[model samples]
Target: MSVLDQDLKTPIRLRSLTWLRAPWLFWGGLLILTWAVSHYAFDIYRALDARWIIRFPATWQPDFESRITAFMDWLLHDAQLFGILFRDVTRAISAVIEAPYDLVVDVLVTGLQQGIGQQAVQILPPLSWVAVIFTVTAVGHYTKSWSMAVLMGLCFTYLAVFGQWESAMLTLASVLIAVPIAAGGGLLLGVLAFRVRWVDRAMRPILDLMQTVPVFAYLVPILFMFGFGPVSALVATIIYAMPPMIRVTIVALRGVPEELAELGRMVGCTRRQQMWKVLVPSAKPMLMVGVNQVIMLTLNMVIIASMIGAGGLGYDVLTALRRLDIGGGVEAGLAIVVLAIALDRLSQAYAGRTVTQKAAQSQGGFAMRHRWSLSIIAVILVTGLIGAAASWLQTYPDALVINTGQIWENAIGYINVNYFDTLDAAKTFLLTWFLLPVRQFFVGIPWPWGLMAMTLIGLRVGGWKLSLLVFVLTGLIVLSGLWDKAMMTVYLCGASVVIASAIGIPLGLLAASNPVSNRIVGAFIDTLQTLPSFVYLIPVVMLFRVGDFSAMIAIVAYALAPAVRYAAHGIRSIDPQIIEAGIVSGCTRGQLMRRIKLPMILPELLLGLNQTIMLALSMLVITALVGTRDLGQEVYIALTRANTGQGIVAGLSVAFIAIIADRLLEAAAKRMRKQMGMA
Candidate 1:
């Protein structure tokens, strides 16, 4: 067809599309046209002649902050439920949570004491560092391989030698106590959800909210209800960590084969027995996966929970950051990384063991089977007997302990001094040329125009209900007087996500294309993911000082793994037959990737983007530590002031932004899958 014919057909197409005739097409077109004009052509405030549309006027903004704070105060100090004082109820709950936590802390961290004040004698020193290290190594050896044993031994030794043992132990104690509770609770809930349709339906959104909401958002409420202490931190960590375990539990249990359940029924097993014995055992491998997730998440929360008084390695890092002691922060951060790697590796090793391997190990005599346990007991006994004389056995001696803090500080100082101009130039160039302009553009857009654009996009992607949801959520941000801060968050998180994707996609492609590259990239990505998000701030802050640039670098480092992992998995998962057909059709490698592979993997890339966005938003909150003036900073400020309302509102605003992005991207991915007939 000539250009004239094509142009003539356009009028007929337009004529056929109207509200009464083709509402979806007509509305979609109208929305796109409206968005294009409002976003690109029409200056919103100038055209409307209303400054209130540009920035929500303070007088008009709702007093949600005060209202929320007041409600929290009443709930904490005066409210009653079912004729019971809420404060008393919280106290009772706190006691229950505190009991096990205290016991674990005493056993693993704080030494038992006899008497009081100066007369007090240390009846026991918190498991001798030597014993702890030996036990960790022994557990590693018993569960997996000598390599794992060596890894654990080295990790624990690093803590002891580097003067981080006590703090690391405190962190570990919390993790050890939290993991079983969170994982078990998650398992029970998941089982219930699997058994009951309504329970599953009800839990889906709650689980989504629990996982989507930033960890800092809940800290204020937890502190208010539970009182500020490690117990509050414990509660916060549980909430932050349990969602993944529950999600994994549901997925794992659902993935169990039906044949095993049928076999149990045929053998005269009751429903309870069938579920407990047949279904659960069959899902053990996957259940362990959930447990692993619980471990990792618990470690992540340890850092954030420190702000509320769960003092440990997290508190050390926080203190160091607060004082601007780069060396000290890096040392503490590295300790966290070491602890995380050890836990992650141990859990993974245990999870990877086969039923046959376990059964084989179980057949040994009692003494042989329990050799590692016996060795740990022997070491502890020996240390207790000799520790009074050889005090170093009880605690790592201060004189011998390594001080890498100075070394790290000196290294960072050297770099900053030697490369100041070059680093400053690059940072300035990026901020001035790209970041500032983008931020200004986003901040300058009228609130109404931005909201409408989102609503229209939501409608196009997921229809009217989603559009309404987006409108209300975004409108709430505006009314809460957080639109500008929210936009700043968008600017920061969006920039980080874009940079992460650019770096990750190529790496993912390389990993997907070659076995060696896959192994190398997979290992690197795994290590990156295991480190707590807080740790990322250390090196970046050291290099760039405190600013948005540092925060962006941290966010990118923390979020890059998902994008790479998802991209690699997506490409590697493509049907071999399809690739073969492309090859037979004379497509070059580049041509095949461009025309076939990339298109096929586009949905996966979108899903990866969704994950990247979620991670960046979560990291965005932590980035507040380095002085980013976004919603994260608002939450941080609220936390410091103990302003429950401000923190919750700011947190909800961040979560709303995340949810909006999540829903839009997910809807787009779903649509793509349908279009490709892959759904």
Candidate 2:
């Protein structure tokens, strides 16, 4: 038998240098040589002025942005082929999308922002805390699980009692607009991609770009096109949330049985009929999952959307962040989590509610059969009566609303007082010892040398096409004059990924050792991923006080979820037959893990690395707000100034970094698969 197939009770032992294959020697030598040349050759690595660097002309710097803007204007207007038609097209789309958005905003916003009610002298009243609570309870009961219903009620009640009702309502209203548009648009697009080979191929790159592009980056083009406020936020959220659904839809449609499709064909079904009756019905389970994803992603964008004026809970969090109001900020952040958890569980329940024909026939209770219609009617009646009878029911009274702000304030205050010196010393040490060397290593590398090394790595892994793509993107970042900022961003993300992986892998392995631990770890990961991104900065600011260290800690928290999850999944997914073989051979626990489990799960582990890196990079823009001088910082600066060119260039730089890392890891994963004979 091949050594790879053999199961031995003893652990596999290797002689020194025996495992160092030719590919490793070649790639390792190339990277080292490139690093030497980049760092030591003719002092070309300096940022202020450097050899082997191509700088954009100084002459074009002054009006470059205006020139680009002018060109675009001309292309959209002076270039007459698409002038009036383009305008009409955008106008028609705007009319269709904005009408419902306006109605939702009117019903929820403290005043009508824009709608038929805009000219109405009376301000549109917002939903009262009591009414909203009643509505939430009704929806919870509609889920047909009293436990889930109670959890939903408690979560939203925390929001109302903690004095976040108005903001939560505003956030919920915007999400209402966003989820439907995003979900509907995603479903349509998914169908198109599934049905058309050309569309499926074309959409892959676009989806990659959309998914990897930083959330902070999303605001600029959206702000430029739609202008700031809820409309712009709504549009951006839809774009951000659409990709996953489209992907899920394509997968689900393709998952339908070939035999079933053939049956439809034999029955003389038309294309539309076959899709509507056969394919879509079969795909409903996965489509519902995609819908659940859309809702979660829509909620996830709350804090980000608020950056451009989609107010509510997000606005409250942002406001608190700016003012450094720990208590208030914490409350607002928790409110967002509450909203996310409620939405998530409800959606999950709806998705999981599959009943067999026999099961359906045996089902009891009128509510189970007609939950939606009945729930809506009950909610409307209860809310209407309460809202009409009591002024307080129109809006929760401030006296009745409890302020838990003082609690968090005191907690943070005590920590700051007790641990300030210790934290400062620790932060200083990390800055000096840990973060700086890593930052310098990346930032001080000459552009071409690192680029060449990456190109070589890409060639070794994914072949010529991927290598060329990496070259083009790396070249663009250098030409954009953001190379230094890009390097710092890379450094920050790299350090975070390493640290997160170091912590997460062990946790994952431990969790995988038992089912109870796995469940506990899974719950934690879900909670971590669902929390508002802004909330991560809160405790970091309190402790580390906002720099690379604080940013690193926050990035670690945000990115660790995927890493740990991937590790646990990989460990858990090991073939049981392999385990049985190891056990029958009398392999020790350590031998079984080291020889069988870890080696077998290597491909999955690489995939987890890819996701962890992506998550870390996503935090770049947000981390910059806490004062890290990276590409994210530049994006933040551009956002504040509304500098379209700078913001876009920086955003693209971050995306390029993510894409490069993704390509490298994905290629490595494919290589692992090939080794396992699973390719």
Considering every candidate listed, which one attains the maximal lDDT?
Answer: 1
Q: Write the per-residue lDDT of candidate 1 for residues 244-343, one digit (tens) a residue.
A: 8888878887888888777999999998998898888888888888888888889889889999999999999888887878888888888988998998
Model 1's C-alpha root-mean-square deviation from the true structure amounts to 4.0
Model 1 CA lDDT for position 13: 45
Consecutive 10-residue window with the lowest summed lDDT within model 1: 13-22
Residue-level lDDT for 276 in candidate 1: 93
Could you tell me how far off, in angstroms, the CA of residue 677 lies in candidate 2 after the best superposition? Answer: 1.3
Q: Candidate 1, residue 434: CA error in Å?
A: 1.8
